[model samples]
Target: MNLLLVEDDLDLGNGVRIALANQGMDVVWVRRLDDALRTLDGGTFDMVLLDLGLPDGDGLDLLFRLRRDRQILPVLVLSARDALNDRLRSLDDGADDYLVKPFALAELLSRVRALARRSYGFNDETIRMRGLALHEPTRGVIVDGEPVELSRCEFDLLALLLKRTGRVVTRRVMEEQVLPGGQANGSNSLEVHISNLRKKIGQGYIRTVRGIGYVIDVQSLARSTQK
Candidate 1:
């Protein structure tokens, strides 16, 4: 999962970022409301961990802007405002979930996972595609009941592809989400990774769409599994 964390406190932000990354989430942290807005405008994340207080402006203003623009991405407010009215106002203004400061990290991770499942419509943490299974929590992949060894990038790529099975995932989208910090790779690194992934999982499962992108053929996977 990819998450955008908007927080001004350096210590908290760094701690949360490390924790979330350890949980297999790609987290991008920004300290200011303007930076948060800019990150939102450019990147796609599974969820937003927003602090109600930001350096540039109130985080609620950013939330209001997102709602006004009809952005449906899940936003979970993380703030020190522990008033009943604060929580109510946040939900009313379009925040999906609210967590007060000095909370348990485990609880925060649970909430983030819940928001991710809700936003992505994932019924479970494990994704099954025919004989292939990608378990998000374990960071493990299995094919035909056998473990398949894959690098971190390969697993992330396969997980993304499985989530969007049968649809062509655009090159730009893949690069942004699968790459580190949405950085552009000048080399053919993506292709190299994809090629390695195909070699491990079987080339028939993934198909390149010529100039567009790549796709995981669910139907083809089903057919192959049945045979």
Candidate 2:
């Protein structure tokens, strides 16, 4: 998943980014609320990790603007304010969850997963498409009851494709979700990942749409498995 992390504390931000990246999430970190708002307006993210204490402005005001504009991206606030009013204010401003400073990384990850599940209307950690099952918590994939070993990037790419099965996921979208800040990796990098994934999942499962992008044929995958 693509996540925007708005935090002013350099050490904390770096730690959280590394932790989330290890968990197969692409995160873009910004220190100021203005930068966060700019990124939010210009880019696509599955969720936001916002810190209330920003150098430029309060995170709650940013949340308020997002809510006012009807931006439905899941937001989880992180703050040093552990008081009842502060927590309630953040929730009232449209934060999906709140975490006080000195929180555990595991707890933060759990809350993120829960919010994502609610947004996707899924109650379980495993996402099943056709005969391919992806276990988010464990970072495992099983195809046709057989475990499939994948590189980190390959797993992330496949997860994004499977999540939006049947839809033509543009290269830009895939890049954003698979790579942080949509960094300038060569164009062929994505293709290489797709090729590697195809070798593992079977050739016909993922279709390249020429200049457009790629799509996962979930129905065809099911039929092939049945046959």
Candidate 3:
């Protein structure tokens, strides 16, 4: 999942970014409300982890602006304001879920999954295509009723390709979305991950698009499993 994290505190933001990245989420972190808004304007995200207090402006105003402009993505408010009214106000304004500060990361993850199921409608957090099933919460992969062990990068790569079944995912998009950072391409790391992922998932999936990119053909997926 692509997540936008809007936070000002350096320590907390770094910690959260690392934790989210460990879970195979593509996260973009910004400290100020203006930066957050600019990121939102330019990028597409599945969820927003928003801090109610920002350096440039109130995070509530940003939430309001998102709603006023009709951008209907899930927003989970992470605030130190623990009052009932604060929670109520956040929900009323457009936040999908609220978490008071100093909370557990496990709880945050749970809420994130719940919001994902709510927003995207993968009720069980499992995205299935062909003979493969990718479970989000456990990061488990199963092929033809057999479990497939995969490295973190391989699992993330498969999830991206599986989520976009039948659609081409370009190399640039994969690097920007799936790679750890700029230096991740030290020596064709993305291709290595894709090759490993394809091997684990088996044949007849993840076809290369010449010089363009890669895609998992949905029609071929059905045929592969059926045969």
The prediction achieving the highest TM-score against the true structure is 1
Model 1 lDDT per residue over 88-134, tens place: 99999999999999888899999987876665445457877768888
Q: Which stretches of candidate 3 lie over 4 Å from their true place?
A: 123-125, 128-227
Local error of candidate 3 at residue 60 (angstroms): 0.9
Across 13-118, the per-residue lDDT of candidate 3 in tens digits comes to 8998898898888899999999998898776677899999887888999999989986667899999999999999999999999999988888888898888776
Better of 2 and 3 by lDDT: 3
Deviation in Å, model 1, residue 81 alpha carbon: 0.6
Query: What do the candidate models score in CA lDDT, each in turn?
Result: 0.82, 0.81, 0.82
**Model 1: how far is 76 from its true place, Å?**
0.8
Global local distance difference test of model 3: 0.82
Cα error of candidate 2 at position 163, Å: 5.4
Total backbone collisions, model 1: 0
TM-score against native, each model: 0.62, 0.60, 0.59
lDDT of 3 at 225: 38
Clashes of 3: 0
User: Which residue runs does candidate 2 get wrong by more than 4 Å?
Assistant: 123-227
